[model samples]
Target: MTAAAACDTAALTAHLVARGLTASPAGVEIHPLAGGVSNDVVAVRAPGLDAVVKQALGRLRVAEEWLADPARLDTEGRALRLAGRIAPGSAPEVFDLSDGYLVIERAPDSWVPWKQQLLEGTADPAVAGRLGSVLGAYQRATADRDDVLREFGDVTAFGQLRVDPFHRTIAARHPDLAEAIGHTVDVMAASRVCLVHGDYTPKNVLVDPDGERLWVIDWEVAHVGDPTFDPAWTIGHLLLKTVHRPAAGAGFAAAGRAFLTAFTESIAGALPIDPAQLVRQTGCLLLARVDGKSPADYLTADERPRVRDLARRLLIDPPETITDAWELLA
Candidate 1:
């Protein structure tokens, strides 16, 4: 490895050795994995073990102010553990964790981020369907699992994560967004309950090179409450991504719709939420554009005309069908 790469790896290996994941003189080898906007992940090879070590830094390696979140790393271990329980195959076992570090089983280095595949025009929607199916199982299994899901209950404070930063901070700086976003407090208060992956976009998923199973990662903002948490998130990102890359986006949405439709059907009997509850959740998803902390900076100036237009129609005046809401994202 190069010196800069070593800079991100050796310190952690030493930390792990002290924690008993590896022996002090075991001749460990480390390979740093780089990509994504907010993490430092590395592959570690030791005499008795092979593992992927990851850490979340407070500031993004990139200079985007909206990407910064100091509290994110602390939520990693809990989210991964919960995800492993619900969909064991989707995540590697969590071998160890501390302050800002996470260690899990090492998968093939050939893993491709679902986003890059979509951009390159090769992502499979059927795999996304399986993702949706498994996520539905996760919700059903964990909904009342000894209140474990409920312990991570701060998702109700979504107005803070989803609303204030965009409205009070970023969108407030722009005159165009100012009027529509002004006094947006009441817009979020109603539907602020549910266990949501708060950042469940495609950028957070990885597909094994064979184009088979999927792995969903990055759960710093995950919490319990809404059934629409995962689906609405998937829908909105689908709309945004599709608008950006027409062909791949189209494929993603078709697969997403299939996944979500199946997921809803599977969990219909188990969801504690009613129509009013889901409607409220969908509305909360709409405000995600104007009031969300990170906002949707993933879109371009040309795309915002469409995204913002959809956010307003949906947030301010919603349609009856959840499918109708998806078109805004498209």
Candidate 2:
């Protein structure tokens, strides 16, 4: 089945029944979930079944002509399972991995995205700490593992979804910073120490209403690569939020620090990456959201220049730490 066709309720329901994931479609209800540009995500609820079905789109839902491999569904399925084992409840359980889609455990109805909370100026440091712990655990457990390398070593999907749109596209647009961006890209491509969640932003993190447990979604870009990518992406996002809402900068900064402290502690100081690397990655990510194929919808016209200016500075002369990066917004 085509990715485009999989978006329909009828097609998804039929797919579920054919896979025997659902006993019957009698009382099943499927509704499309909003947000996300790369995949068609639907929430399927039925008798004793609560799941999300996602199918990779060959072309993303963006203004630019971004095309990715539909086989990324297979990658996400494998990565989700591995992530679940590594972090234990940090990722959704994979129920089925079919030809073109995945049926996975869904977050509770009350669960909301961490991105939403951040946008509302509710930056919880504890939540950041938990996210850091899970990311550190995932990278630490999979670091240098031959089995992990063999299974997720491929960077094809990562390049298509991340490097091309964000890094490469941004490089072409910013000629002066192209050298710096190119260097960052080179370093990322050379490093293959652990599994990198290419899209490890707050938007992908689902927080339970009670704020006790959280789940990280969207693993289609997961691969065996630089460990810095995941942490940088997460920290970068916190920094982005700080820029977006300067009045609430203290909260976001606190969360950034909490995440770094917890991440470092979780890894037991074994994986020491140059702080500059993270600065560069964060800069690249910030610039990507403002000018790359997928712009940050939340950023306003007045905020775009601020992000662009900060991104360039981050690329040119990176700060000593993510905390320092937060200070730039002030």
| CA RMSD per model (angstroms) | 4.2, 2.0
Best by lDDT: 2
Q: Highest TM-score among the candidates is held by which one?
A: 2
lDDT of 2 by residue, 61-165 (tens): 998799999898898999999999988899999999987879999888899999999999999999999998888898789888899999998888899999999
TM-score of each candidate?
A: 0.77, 0.96
Candidate 2 Cα deviation (angstroms), residue 4: 7.5
Q: After superposing candidate 2 on the true structure, give the runs of residues whose Cα lies further than 4 Å from its correct spot.
A: 1-7
- Residue 136, candidate 2: Cα error in Å is 0.6
Tens digits of per-residue lDDT for model 1 on 144-244? 55475556765433434444544455345555545444434343333334445666667777788766777777776676655665666666666666666
